[model samples]
Target: MSRRNVYLDLIPPRQAVQRACDALNRKELVQTETIPTHEAAGRTLATSVTARCSSPTFHSAAMDGVAVRAADTFAAREDAPLELQKGRDYDPVNTGNPLPEGRDAVIMIENVLQVDDSTIRIEAPAFPWNHVRRIGEDIVATELLLPQGRVLSAYDVGALLAAGIWEIQVLERLRMTFIPTGDEVLDFSQRPTPQPGQVIESNSQVFASLARSWNAIPSRTATIPDDAAALTQAVRDALASDAHIVVVGAGSSAGSRDYTKAVFEQVGTLLCHGINVMPGKPTLLAEAQGKLLVGAPGYPVSAVICFEDVLAPIAAYLSRRDAPQRRSLPVQLIRRTPSRLGQEEVVRLAVGEVRGRFLAAPLSRGAGMITTLTEAQAVTRIPTSVDGVEAGKTVTAELLVPEAELSRVLIHVGSHDNTLDLLADALMGLEVPLRLTSSHVGSMGGLTAVKNGTALFAGAHLFDPETRDFNFPFLRRYLPNLAVQVVNLAIRHQGLIVPRGNPKGIQGVSDLTRKDIRFINRQRGAGTRILLDHHLEVEGVDFEQVRGYEHEEFTHMAVAVNVLTGAADCGLGIRAAAEALDLDFVPLARERYDLIFPAEHAEDFRLQALLALIGTEAFKQRINNLGGYETTLTGQTMHPGQGLE
Candidate 1:
């Protein structure tokens, strides 16, 4: 049997961080260097900075006026004006000009009446030291300007220059070197197309970008294979360099091919091998040659959590700066999300302001799905003690985007459609862009979200076999009290997506009874599933006879991908999905897809803009260009009992 590395006792994220902190001696590991004060912005000070020279070394004029002694101008009054020669009683001065030797006050140019070239008259008495900047007024010589361990800002640079401090001693930026290790990883710099088992290497660049944001110097070595000796040498080399931290990407799990843990043990003391957090459990931490070594998981989301939560804090400690924190807000969850009991799961959310409160919908939890993070505006953590969070429950969420952006987010919880993507893109082209963040929970789930007041709007295409009507029938039954307005987005075709060549010879719904035909299905509440059941009944085919009927996908695109990848022979989905993946489609029915909005939110500016946008000829044209949609009712509002016509 090939030897595999076992994880150390799984500890909480905070405890693992504390162990790394206590093991490393910052004073010995990090050093200070002198650099120009102007170039020290964003750097932490190694020592306290004092002013060498006071601001305004000499008494100077604060305004453009005439410098004068207060005693000489005491006799001047508004009722009795007095005149004096410029050189004898006052000296002309502009802002910042040095005050004359005996002058104790400044008279405004507007207050003086110029009678001649060298003389002026004043009507008001000048007060002593009025509008005069005395020596050391802004800053005093030998006074503390900045304290040690303070992170410098651009304003701090200006203060340093004004206080006559030419140079500053700042803690050296923490240097980080990333080593990507895996035979299955390909360097993204080459732009190589990944084969089945190969994945493009991008975690290193992700870490590098994050490192820069933390004021750390980041470098990356070329990808190294999964050989134990090779990885050990790479870590040793990284340690030998000036790098304070070495991160080995991938090969950190308990798989037989994973060699990072073994390499960490060979060259250093393994402080932690796993963390009690989902998506980031395989994080490895070790100390070698008085430097930090990390083994990061290959999964994109897992790697981000490791970099942000684990490594970022340690880096902040070394750099003598406070770790960055995101703003948090309370949000209402739109759907029940389940999680395991042992680990804390980071659930990314599509958060937006609906009515006056924040509503959040959980995105995908796949550790390898990087798009989830990109699309999320906030994230909430599910506690280890809880099994899941129920719908309509309020939880505190850490914001991933600016708080102001929440209002501009248009939350749509509903069925998945390609036309919605077109609408999303068009909404962004408005003068004030609106972000359309959607959660595909099926049409029925959308109605539930609307009923709970968790979504700004929803997309649904529910069909009633008895009434031969769409969403109206379902709304009348499921939500009798809530008032809503429906608008037709488009009329779309639903069909069975097969391989490009239709290898399975699947012709119609009756073929589902054939043992050789494998089918993919949508989730229970999805409108597509209802359509499929209707067709199965009309064909007199038993649902139990269909192979892979229980296999469910959330979106039309997901269903198309199953067929594209040969996981299923065919799946019932929208025509756009089949066209997108270059698959063959067998048309089944044409359905009216509509947007459902709460009656109270009908006048909301975001909703109004959406309504106006879809009504435009250009937008209707775009829908027609999609090849599988009818634009006859593209942007018209619907009344009860209006079916297809």
Candidate 2:
């Protein structure tokens, strides 16, 4: 066994970017070329553009009327009308028409009365240069039309054409090549179904798309294996070509197989090894042949942060354009987000405008989960000095989506169910589409979020064995004073999810204690966990006797996955979850799953739309279609004493 290369002294991402920017000489690396003016939109100017010819080189008509010498119409008046001969006294012109020779003014057609084919009568006097576009009025010959380094827009194209600029000198679009590495990475172009321990390589495509958005040229080479010599050759080849930046995706960490640092050191000057950020800490920066070389982490989120925080700035500098910035807004945190003391953390948030204010719920923080980026409407940063942001505290968030879309987001801070997924899709089908963003933090967490006024609504299914009820008992115990409206989403069956064909022949809770039957459980404070405990008590099984009881998952689907993957023999979850993955289900108790909304937000349009959609028979039928769900009490208001009525 050989020791791997450790990271150099960690630096702030901004400082690393500045160091790269200071090292790369853009004038020597980035070339400029002449391109057609019409094809130069979104391209940066290499030098100031001067007009080749004056706009309206000759005096032209600015209005549709008659052109005549001012002295010819000076004596005309309302009381004494004057007659003029066509061509000699005046000439008819339309907008943008060139003025005839000797014409100094224009008599509007509305004021001129036609007497005959050769003559017309006029009552108003014409003034010099009236309704005329004078030469050099807009653009003067040899005048600066656009400044150097200006990013050309569509309007700039039209201006350039009018100024007689047929071609322009622009800085070349930055070229980047991404090389994906790893033996476990399957080529996405082949669309190969991934077996265990294999993953489809997609970070190259992500980087390519992001580079395109930055107006830079992006290409990818075939996947490279975890060979240091091969990676070094790839980097040298990219540098030998015209690529301004070279990126080696994955294998940048401290693992034995991670060879990016070694390859970078072999071919280039290592400017940075690690960043002082959470998801993007493994970022590497180096200069190879006066060009930027970036070693991005393997995780999707970390790669995105590396590209956005480090590569984007250097790219903008190379092309002489400002980096793109996202819109930002202050949003109240719906949950407590903890972070370490040293590294800055980026937290993705599901943000929505609720009750005339913006509310944000933190999504999953896993760097490998790209869905967090798709689901997040915004992202906030926890500074390196701070430990974390507390619930109900406001933080300024950089928006991933448009600000207007925030009002259409419906935030759910608790309990995961298959019905919620269906509801989310159904909401999007409405006349005014609404996006449902849910955070599965258990039933108790839902009540806590509602009490904190962080969520617009929450889903709950808390069961009370003493009262023989669900949700209401816990609501009274936890939230005694806050007024809320409870609406039943469905009465769902909860059961033990087992592998296909029930290889373990697990019957029910009685089988849970068997040494052969390793049971997976839900997290504490989860309604499903409570239900499992109640069943274990009834079956005379002690809590400590159940194997894998403490191996907890957060959602029903996750629990079912544990069973399906052979990690456990059986786990308790909703039948829908088992049915979803084609697993066997053992019948058990059924309970109500309800949506809780604060009474004050009863009139909110988003909440009202949800209520209206759920009340319809169509939504109920959809619920019934999911299998193992009873919609008899669906969309109806729930009371404390109402138990499965």
Candidate 3:
């Protein structure tokens, strides 16, 4: 094989997508198939479908009543009732039952008095066609039931079946075959416990699911190693099969091990080797052996971006359907987001509505962070010409969740606590579900978010050494003018989290300065970090004495995990976090954690529901079970002027 292509010839994402779509159209990839209409929901129609027969084939009764000739009861009145003999003047009929011969109307059973088995009396006149279902009322014979190119819905299936359409001609489902490559990739089907340097193959599964969502049939082949001959053979085999598109996972970059472009060249023509998009820049597109071939990056997030931006349009075109439109809404960005000037960036956003305005917080931008994709509620695109978006700027965000769900999201920005995850779960369990979206930017960061009007509330546990109090001292200094209600969420144990059995024999704060020990610290503004500083001051330990002090994580769970995984000897966090990971804990202090709510929003219905839930016995029990929380003051409220002494 020739040397790997050094230059990618990157093009804008739109141009790359259009090139794939144009190739699909030029090759006439779309085809049609006939299937039972009962199985046609979500499939696009190939041709206009017309009714073979009218619904309610014959005049049928619309209610459980007695069918009669309207002329027989025309003179009836409430004062003087009219009597008629059964079989001669009336016949019993149930809803959807065909009316007897010559019957033109129906009198509800409740409206008629049964005098005997053979007779009945009516108190009111029955008008012509009263409560009668007319022929062709719902559908007329030979009328159009669905237009060409229409996508079938569940209700459409019922309508088609009712109109005597047993089979329908629909656009054929686009068949996509995904081949994951790389010697380091392990098949998860074997349930293998991976050692170092081996990554479980998952990107192909992600592609398969995404393809299914776009109404395409997806099949994944066994994992292929990085050998060029094997990969070429797999691609050629896929092309020979019934696949309309073949996606090769990973090995798309310019690395010496990357051979996707070479394989494509051997089989057919390489259309484009790269796209100028963040996360998905290494995307490759090609047309070979009458099928489109795509090279998706190994990173999970990048793989998703490539599938959606490059392959989705081609699949839609081949399936004879329009591409799905993402719902876009204007949202206020919580912080300044930087992006490369020449590449179009897709920023995943954790979006929620606060104070009648939608606020979007961008998630981590790492291409391999799959959690960002799962947790993101929406994504905002930064055009290639722009450098980035500034804080407090408005941008259009494409929603991953329904737009209506944004109204139900409670925006919590501040210190990270494991209890917040439990609270989020509880809130979603309510009859009218509420979702909590929290950003772990530390206590001070959370307060800033509230002050900026981008958050409904903030989780804070700021410790003030001078006054020896929690939250209020810092709130007064930072948000003195903003009227707020501080509600205690928990009084949780703050301590040193060490590995199981305390293998390092870490005792207390002074031990953090020991030359042999490595410590993990929380982010600077985090409440746990503030507490750590207080202990270090009292112990007279210089910050420089502690090894790995600069290394930080945003959440207690993350800090504890680092210790559990042997990355650190100890870290300061809550006992709940230590207990969760089976780590040993050295007791330090118990501090108050509170939720700071804007005073004006105290009575907001959603906030009220959240507060009530916090005070519930079930919520308190859950906190107690976490093994480090005190619930006696869980929901107590304090005003701005009130100080904790």
Which candidate, 1 or 2, would have the higher lDDT against the true structure? 1
Per-residue lDDT for 202 in model 1? 91
Candidate 2 similarity to native, TM-score: 0.95
Local distance difference test, each candidate:
0.92, 0.91, 0.89
lDDT (tens digit, per residue) of candidate 3 on 1-645: 546667458897678777877666533566788999999999999999899989879899998999999999988998989998999999999999988999999999889899999999999989888998988889999998899989899999999999999999988888989999999999988888888789999897888788889988899999999999999999999999998889999999888889998999888888898898888988999888567999999999989889888778777777767776898999999999999998899999999988788899999899999989888899999998999999999999999999999888898999999899889999999999998888899999999988889898999988877777778888778888998988989888899999889987999999988988999999988988888988999999998899989999999999999998889999999999999999899999888889999989988878998999999999999999999988888888955444343
Model 1 misplaced stretches (Cα beyond 4 Å): 115-119
Predict model 2's lDDT versus the native: 0.91
Q: Among these predicted structures, which one has the highest TM-score?
A: 1
lDDT of 1 at 261: 89
Q: Write the per-residue lDDT of candidate 2 for residues 142-241, one digit (tens) a residue.
A: 9999999999999999999999999999999999999999999999999999999999999999999999999999999989998878888888999899
Backbone clash count, each prediction separately: 1, 0, 0
* Candidate 3, residue 172: how far the Cα is off, in Å: 2.2
- Per-prediction TM-score: 0.97, 0.95, 0.85
- List candidate 2 segments past 4 Å from native: 71-89, 107-126
RMSD of 1: 1.6
For candidate 3, give the lDDT of residue 226: 91
